[model samples]
Target: MLLPFFQEDLVEAGCDEAGRGCLAGPVFAAAVILPKDFYHPLLNDSKQITEEQRNELRPVIEQRSLAFAVAQLDHKQIDKLNILKASFKAMHLAVKKLQAQPGLLLIDGNRFSPFKRVPHKCIVGGDGKYASIAAASVLAKTYRDDFMKELHNKYPRYNWAQNKGYATKEHQAALDKYGPCRYHRKTFRLDYSQPRLVTMTPSVNSLSLNSEVAVSAE
Candidate 1:
């Protein structure tokens, strides 16, 4: 079972991002402050679940969480600041939108750009270990997939509905056949021979929660 909170005395928000590895579409992030007692057997790392499961959990999380917000930075912003900073900026934007301010932030990844006065904890696989982080992951992934599906409607040739802009073999083949569209990331190495986004590491400022209980990286 996922831990409910890092500490007992403060409002905590779990944060995560989606679509960093995509060849196109905006990178999205979500900040979810779930109740201390929130629990769902299906909650886990977004990547570990199927599309159906993520979608199912999105509403459950929204209905149960204390406060939640989702935000994104598009291809232009990604190009201007680079994907890493854009991801951090997106996370910051989401955090700023929460109806209730969080005293502590549980960030899914190991690096973050820190949200103003709020402190944060970065877990290597936080979504699988923390209920709030898993909730954020569901929101981020489901919302990003929805955005990509909309983009797919206008640019069907890219098959974004299927690949969600990942560097998949089919996506590369499409880029080769029709070249890039207005939504494509011009700054990215868009070659078919290029590796997937998982091979990359984006640099950024680190964040950790105040009085956080540290768990070894998974």
Candidate 2:
């Protein structure tokens, strides 16, 4: 069973991010302030649950939580700051949008960039150990998966709906044949041998660059 809170008599928000390791799509983060009495037998780390379970838990978490917010940092921002910093920024943005200010932040990972004046505790596997962090993980993963599914509609060749923007073998094969669309992170190692895709004309390049966009769902 997951613990309810790290500190007693304090409003604590759990923070977690998803898609930081993906080759495409934005990194999504969620911050959730659950009720002190919140408890669910099925709640755990997002990775441990099936898609159906995550989807089911999302609405439950949102409905039950005191305050919850989701945010994302796009591929461009990830390339600019690197994935680690981008993940942190996404979490920070989520926390900023929360209706209830948390006295403590329970971060899922081992490291977190301090958010404003909030104190935080970094638990390496907090998602599995804490109820609120598990709830946040579910929201982050489900939101990012939904966004990637939408992107897949625009570029079906990449098979993003199935791979969810991960660097899978099929995704690499698609990159070899079609090169990369604007949504592909230019900083990531798309091609080990070639390193970079063939340069396109100014107009086409501009269009492709503009296509690399982020979707925000809160």
Candidate 3:
């Protein structure tokens, strides 16, 4: 039931980002400009669908969309700019790479740093409300998941393939044992003292200046 466009007369690109809540890996964003007639029953918010569904939609969105691009900001940049700015920066990078210029940007959050000359409309849950934004969500999540799976090959103990770098109990257990690798966001509050694991000890206090649980608005 997602709408096709926010403004029918203007060229619109829907923008969204993913991987914000993970303890490791880069944050990814995508911009998608769908055709006037784009339609799919499975097109919806990425969070509401299964991995298989998102993967299935990725290729279809790529081939059917008028223009689409995905981009990411690594942990290093994320630490430097903070995740919020990095997320927006990632979106800007994706938007800039689109083959077709967008007259309007339908962003999937309440706030966004303006992109060049383009105007934007921020909807809190825009991804579920609009087709292009949902398409962008699928692309951003799939691309980030692929990158994390590749990293999992190098460090299987963290189990990036399964956890996808989220602060899950298993992931916390890995951090408790192996500590943060280069992929772990240094600025993220990975407080091991958290009762998330009964055996969890304070391993990250020495690593991060802050030790609070870092929740992501992915």
TM-score winner: 2
Q: What ranges in model 3 sit over 4 Å off?
A: 193-218
How would you encode candidate 2's per-residue C-alpha lDDT over 38-100 as one tens digit per residue? 987789999999999999898899888999988888888889999999899889988888888
Q: Cα lDDT of model 3 overall?
A: 0.84
Ranking by TM-score: 2, 3, 1
TM-score of 2: 0.88
Model 1 Cα lDDT, one tens digit per residue, 57-156: 9888888888888888888788889999999988888888888888999999889887888988899899899989988898989988987787676678
Residue-wise C-alpha lDDT for candidate 3, range 1-218, written one tens digit per residue:
99999878999999999998888878889999999899999999999999999999998999899899888888888899999998999899889888899899999989999999999999999999999999999999998888778777778888889999999999988887767777788899885543332233323232122211121111
Q: For model 2, what is the error of residue 20's alpha carbon versus the real structure, in angstroms, after optimal superposition? A: 0.2
Listed per model in order, the count of residue pairs whose N, CA or C atoms clash below 3 Å is 3, 0, 0
Cα lDDT computed for each candidate against the true fold: 0.81, 0.84, 0.84
Give the clashing pairs for model 3: none
Pairs of residues at least 3 apart in sequence or in different chains that clash in candidate 1 = 120-208, 120-209, 121-209
> lDDT at 97 for candidate 3?
84
